[model samples]
Target: MRAGRLRHRITFQVPGEVQDQQTGEMVSGWETVWEKVPASVEALSARDLIAAQAGQSEASGRMVIRYRAGVLPMMRILHRGDAYNIQGPPLPDPDSGLEYLTILVAKGVNDG
Candidate 1:
């Protein structure tokens, strides 16, 4: 086996309220942002073995998660040929009263 890299591009939206300067009114909408992350896996490593085993199972599994603030429509970029096990939840800005996009990634065996 050879080392592999996985690339992922994850995206999500956050709820936000904006005030109109002229009308003095409030408006709500979904803001989107994206981020790119790279992960590498070595063949025959513990991580790789685990990922392969997980992939073999038909059960649902957990994923790795990450969050970013002040960034809308969150996204991720994973490297190619690598397996990933990731997950995340929204990173909310209390002051702004908005949630951040959560990204999740996971590794599994090829079912095909």
Candidate 2:
């Protein structure tokens, strides 16, 4: 794994319950489990297709980073202030000796 490729700053956020002051309802909110994380991000070719869809401005991309525990598809990633919802399960790539976690991210969603 090249250290230079993992230069992009990213963050891992998961849904958390927060009590609404007025209604007392437990509202969903994003809690940053990890911040300022290092990752290698790349825009997938199909991202343009996702972004072109009507009534949706979301896009898709790929991120490569060192493996860590406790990250799931339910969690979303924030890169450069853009929210990306995990589209699928995390795959570990050991074929190239990178042994990195490859995550598929969809852009523009996960605001909730």
Candidate whose lDDT is highest: 2
What's the lDDT for candidate 2?
0.81
lDDT (C-alpha, whole model) for all candidates: 0.36, 0.81
Candidate 1: list runs displaced more than 4 Å. Answer: 1-5, 17-27, 37-112
Name the regions of candidate 2 deviating beyond 4 angstroms: 19-26, 46-59, 96-98
Tens digits of lDDT, candidate 2, 1-112: 7889999989998899877789999898888899988999988675555654553234367888887877798999999878999876787886853468888778865787
Q: In model 2, which range of ten residues has the least summed lDDT? A: 50-59
Error of 2 at 51 (Å): 17
Highest-TM-score candidate: 2
Q: Which 10 consecutive residues of model 1 have the lowest summed lDDT?
A: 58-67
Flag clash pairs in model 2: none
